[model samples]
Target chain A: MKNIFERNVSGMTERLSRSVIGIAGCGGIGSSAAVSLVRAGVGKLIIADHDRVEPSNLNRQYFFFGDIGEKKTAALRERLLQINPDCVIEAYDKKLEREDLASIFENADILIEAFDKAESKQWLIEEWASVFPERPVISGNGLAGYGDFASLRIRKTGNIYFCGDGKSSDASGLCSARVAVVANMQANLAIELIMNKTGDVK
Target chain B: MGKITVNGHEIDWNDNMTVRNVLDRMKYSFRMLVIKVNGTIVKREDWETFPVPEGADVKVIHLMSGG
Candidate 1:
């Protein structure tokens, strides 16, 4: 009983379905990555964010105009379930503190650091690495402005991976095209990490 | 001059060289960086005092993260 979605991602669905993914933001990267993961048949997602959808966020985020003013995690969860009614999404509309991140995403096999601030990204990664030294945490970085898309890439050390240009400053402004590319790269890297860990499981 | 490897390339390392010295020497101005010295992670606040022993393997990774 494979629908177009499952039939298309035939090889990955099972392993992804057994995995629980955690994303720490629902802005451009988190929202876009969450959509891709759910569509790829990741069975559950634990997403958290303190921001609400802003009208300007439509330029890069995966939210519709009507979603403006709604909490991002909730809005994204709704959008995800609309695509796959069976997918279980736990959307937390709050700022994730150090302990909150550990308790909330305890079951997540992998995590995505999708925040927009440098300090935030660094601290989030530190907390995750401190708690789950073995689990992989994927991130998107240096994706600012447009063109030179080829410069974007995935860089890693131990279990922490970054997918982006590695030097772009956010002052250049965020654009839809480049943002989507990095967002998808984060999602793709998450899938690769998960598959590598589960390849021998099933 | 002593030596150390940073991101796989060996570089001149003076005695009592701190992480800040290595970062400044390498001109890594990127605001976000994850640095490891001899397989042990260095906290940002300790970069000034943390010592890099001679021949230590250091990884000064520049990280860029945003939406």
Candidate 2:
């Protein structure tokens, strides 16, 4: 059998290496999705999250207690690089505004909207559609409390993937299991988009 | 009237209705959700131009996060 890196993907990996994806949040859904995309061989990843890894985040977020107080985007970048040394990971420990959206999204083949705020998520949907109409953006939702993994679904709005319901993360209580499941769903949708596999929707 | 299903709920659809337009008609609050039409996922870009055919089965799943 061929070694993993030496394996032939016929430029699939090369093309993906050249591709850039922007993920707005690095919390529950964002962090988890980032890990998956890294493992999937996505070329480049841009993570933007102003929040720091907190003790509370240890339960659901990917960061450890040791990483507490560390900016989510920065920590995620370090971790992802540890796994895929060649992958280019960028970290932005700041919020995204209308002007910054374009720059952040520039050259990215796909955009993953994982912001914790519903308003910001809306901003991505509108801005990407109006300004960068050709680019594909995926927004996540409904990953809160303790719910069955079956509840999560992936649907396409145009080129954007709306990965869940607008269910408030504040619904009752938040748990790691819920966030992990939804984040995986979001990551799966992104991979499928990158692979051009659209025969099925999850 | 055309018939279609959204998020498991069946509803009436109008002629030449795009997914975004239908979403608006249903007051789906698009920001909080994703829509699936006839097993194919429709993204935000296709909302205005993508047409929903008659008797098409559509599903709209909305996401919510609980604290």
Top lDDT: which candidate number?
A: 1
Span of 10 residues, lowest total lDDT, candidate 2 chain A: A1-10
- Ten-residue region with minimum lDDT total, candidate 1 chain B: B58-67
lDDT (0 to 1) per candidate:
0.85, 0.72
lDDT for A49 (candidate 2): 76
Instruction: List candidate 1 segments past 4 Å from native.
Output: A1-4, A198-202
> What is candidate 2's local distance difference test score?
0.72
lDDT of 1 by residue, A45-102 (tens): 9999999999989999999999999989888999999899889998888998877889
lDDT of 2 by residue, A31-108 (tens): 888998887777788888778888988888889878998888888898998878888887788877877888876767
List TM-scores for all candidates, in order: 0.91, 0.72
